[model samples]
Target chain A: MDLTADMTNQPFPTQLFGDDAIDTAEEKAKPSSRQTVGDPFVENPRMICRDVYVYYAEKCAINNVSIDVGRNEVLAMIGPSGCGKSTFLRCLNRMNDTVGTCRVEGDIRLDDMNIYDPSVDVVPLRASVGMVFQKPNPFPKSIFDNVAYGPKIHGLVSNKTELAEIVETSLTKAGLWNEVKDRLHEPGTGLSGGQQQRLCIARAIAVSPEVILMDEPCSALDPIATAKVEELIAELREQFSIVIVTHAMQQAARVSQRTAYFHLGDLIEVGPTDRIFTNPRHQLTEDYITGRFG
Target chain B: MQNTPQQSPITLRINAGLKKRYNTEKRFKRMGISAIVIAMTFLVFLFGSIISNGYTAFQQTYIQLDVSFDQTFFTGENLAAANFPGLVKKTLYSMFPDVTSRNDKKLLTQLVSSNAAFRLMGMVTKDPKLIGTTQKIWVLADDDVDMLIKGHYDRNVAESNRRINDKQLAWIDALAANGKITKKFNTQFFTSGDSREPEQAGIWGATRGSIYTLFIALALSFPIGVAAAIYLEEFAPNNGWTDLIEININNLAAVPSIIFGLLGLAIFINFWGMPRSTPLVGGLVLTLVTLPTIIIAGRAALKSVPPSIREAALGIGASKIQMVTHHVLPLAMPGMLTGTIIGMARALGETAPLLMIGMIAFIVDIPGSVTDPATVLPVQIFLWADSPERAFTEKTSAAIIMLLAFLMLMNGLAVYFRNKFERKW
Candidate 1:
């Protein structure tokens, strides 16, 4: 996790690590850049990753990387496509277990519990830590049922009215209630792309997960819908910890408190959103942010 | 080559190649349309022939005779001894008193069906008062007489080649002129059981047997097929053994249906000791034949349900089984039922397999249970088709029509289910 420490200590194979060292005086002028060395470590991280490596067969999708998703904060993972941002985010909820060839190594813990522990039942783990996909995958169900699916499957509610209450609260939290209030019985798929994505957010929230993973949740939506989802994400951070994977650097800059830049399956730098954008310690992160090369 | 036409390839090609391409496209479209027309024409021809040949079987010929059942013949000792055929022959002879020679009398007796005497006997037994009185009763005619009445034999053809000879033909003409022979709607054909006498034969027995066979087939195959399909497509890992099983299922669907018959013959009959010719045995055999097709269709149906739906269900904390049962299975049900109908339709038309299982028997009584000795419609048609009798040809066609009608109904229900469960996403 200490980018500068590892860079200075490690001997060779600089090509795999992205940079040899961060000794430039101009890069050191920025104080927030120092967090990139040790832990970008938060006072209280809801979920912590330490030297995590993900492999699909023989190919390494995520190299030795470490980051933290802090409580009541949005940690946006910004990188080019296939840079292992989504892959890393999926590991938090153990969604990658569904992929037969995917293998994850090292510690990915929710609080004190190592989530990758075999003793952990993924069904309940997923209930507690939910995910929203990149595409607006609203189930082919009614709007109300789509939100109720999680709660019903987990047996969180006693009866229909209770489920209805949960659905209403979840949709309201997602800021989709007013637009869809009159047609809750209608199919979730009938909604516009933005509404459908918000419905998916509502579906995740209905389970009352402690942490929500969004994998480029607005990539499929229009700019207007993107702004709406961004606003929702900002509002949602009050109660639930969030880890968002976005290809749009501006989206990460706008919505995240802390941003981690991934380059070629490696976490190159991590710091506060403003500092990472303005004064990236690693040359790769700086070049990427400045559109020099992705 | 390009340098030679560098003046402009587009202009040079447009004048000739464009028209040629357009003409080729037009010709291809014409060929496609012609292909459809030819296919439709064959379909029409087949249906036309079957319908024309089969519709006449729905009607049967009858002879109205003034039968004097003489109550004296039914007295205590003679009640069991009284010869019904003798009484019927005597009654017909008295009416046609002009027939004097012994051979002529024999020819005259063959005019009415052998079942006619039994029919009269049953009527008299039901109502003894009719024995004391003479009543004009309509009785079944012989297969030859029925064929003659229906014009089954070509009148222009030589008498030696036809089923009805010159003497019998004259007798039929005389009877028709006298208003004694009548062609009426064949209600008995729908009500009675199979008979060696073609005119007396009906499909009721076969229909009941088919119902039992189909019920057993559906009951055994559906749950098993669907479950196997779900397991293979959803839960089973992508392993070599799974691949082998999948390949076997596809191959099983294409296997000759008769091979299933041989399996049933070897296993169900020889090894398992299942009683031969019962619907239970036939249904079990058909289930074997139908399983592969149903499984193939079921797997395809399950596969058609998008992976996103599975992911959506799993994302909601639904267990793997729960995900399949709650979403994937329901979405795939219409397709499954459609597949089942297609499989059943094939089973319905199947004759070779059932024949191997002894469903070609000349069963007389309607089957009361699946285990009872029985014959299905297709096997019944096969049996009738093999009979040398002239009238059975029509009965065979009629049975085919009924079988096809049942299949059409099942397919219609399948379409209804498909439409009902066809989801947009």
Candidate 2:
């Protein structure tokens, strides 16, 4: 097979082709300097990822990238498919460890703790850094138990009343308590798609995590549910640091204070959401934000 | 629209094949329907033959005779050793006063089951006040007489070929004339154990043996099979060692059942010195036969649980063990139970393996526990089928019907449990 022909046929940015794919002397002379253009750091950061790389067996899924999650702020990561945004989100709590072939290297810290340290346990790490998936997933259990699962497993509450209180507060915070209060005993899976996603958010909040990672949480929801979840994200930003990966640039602009753009496993740009959307510095970021190419 | 001078070749070819296509479709449907009809016909024929041959075994022949339990012989304290058979003989003689030849008298005595004397002994032993009373009692008739009364034997062939001679038939007809012979529901068939006399035989022993053996097999195999399945599916790494183990497990499911019996004989009997011909040994052998099936089914059940549920649990702070036990296992339980029940049903009908473990013993007494020397239903059916007695032929089919009923009950339970526990999502 002609590897260069296949590479050019792919829709990926030209930087992903490596030095060998540059056939012309002029293109080889001026190599693609794959670099981030805007600031990727933040003040009062709750979590920091530095030089992180992820590989699935022989293939590099996430190239070396660094970014910070500010305290009490929603940080949106927008990228096209296969851009390593979700992979980066999963790396926050080491959820990628569940995939047997996946390998993550470099430093990622939550507060003062190195999450990937040998002495650290994933159970507690995951409890402190909770996640919501692309598709809504609720346990095959009552709505009350679905929210209370994390607190119960983590031994956050000792009594039934305390557990119920935690479940109530979590659901209320997720903006679903009013709708589901009368039917707490019904199965969570029986709820509508938006309600199930909110329930998953409630479950994450019940653990009282320092940061919440959402990987396209509204992708499976309808427009109305998406609006509701975006509103919930805005409300959630007052307490926990939120790192959300989204396919919708409008969603990223609407729900987040800061946005980071990733392309072909590279973080191309990061800045204030308005600045990234209105005045992008990187050409690839501008091209993606303007819909010239994904 | 303009019409072409000649039809397009594709349209012409399609139009030509339309009739043939419809004909093929109709022929296929007819063949499928006929296949099902033929299968149903054979099934109906089989059931008809079994029911016709075995239904008579459910009722038995009885003869009423006047017996005067004389105090001279029956003094209640010595009832156990009394000559009840002699008294029965005397009763027969008084009925046939003209027949004085010893051979004729003996032949007359053959009309009733020898167990009838034991029945009289039991009645007298229970009630001593009947000692000098001439009471009319209905007693069980011999199996040969039962066969004749049920019309299993043709009376027109010849005197030499018939099980009941002309004299016995004449006496039976004479007794019938006086309302002394009748057929009653054979409660003994359900209440008693195996006997040398077919009239006294019952299935209660083999049923209990089957229950005990299956109980042991299920109690041991279900948990072990499920546990092994969980470990191999969830905990074991995807490596060559586990791959080989998986291949071997699948291969073991296809191994002949009698091979498991030989393994049980080698491992549990000769090696472990467990008693042979007991439900315990039989159960252990059956467990070996069913383990692979249960494991395969359990793995399939575990595999069917969507991976999203597992990730959801782990995405929260639940440990791996908690994720599996709290979420995945409950979802997979209905399928696992279905597999276990199917395996148990197969174990219920298994005889060749138990035969290897000596469960084919002719055990006459009802087993009270798993360790007792016992035989299961299929083994009992097999033994009855091997017997030369004509009465045993009906017993074999009856035993088969009982086995089939048990299998249906187990499969029905499987369906009920699946419907009850299965969750949507």
User: lDDT: which candidate is best?
Assistant: 2
TM-score of each: 0.92, 0.93
Model 2 CAPRI rating: medium
Q: Candidate 2 deviates by what RMSD? A: 7.0
Q: How accurate locally is residue B101 in candidate 1, as Cα lDDT from 0 to 100? A: 96
lDDT of 2 by residue, B291-327 (tens): 9999999999999998889989999989999998999
What is the CAPRI rating of model 1's predicted complex?
medium
TM-score of 1: 0.92
lDDT for position A26 in model 2: 43
Which candidate should be chosen as best, given TM-score against the real structure?
2
True contacts kept of 1: 0.57
RMSD after CA superposition, every candidate? 5.1, 7.0
What range of 10 consecutive residues in model 1 chain A has the weakest lDDT sum? A29-38
Model 2 chain B: lowest-lDDT 10 consecutive positions: B1-10
For model 2, state the Cα shift of residue B77 in Å: 3.3
Off by over 4 Å in 2: A1-31, B1-28
lDDT of 1 by residue, B128-168 (tens): 66767888989988988888778877877897797777877
Interface RMSD of 1: 1.1
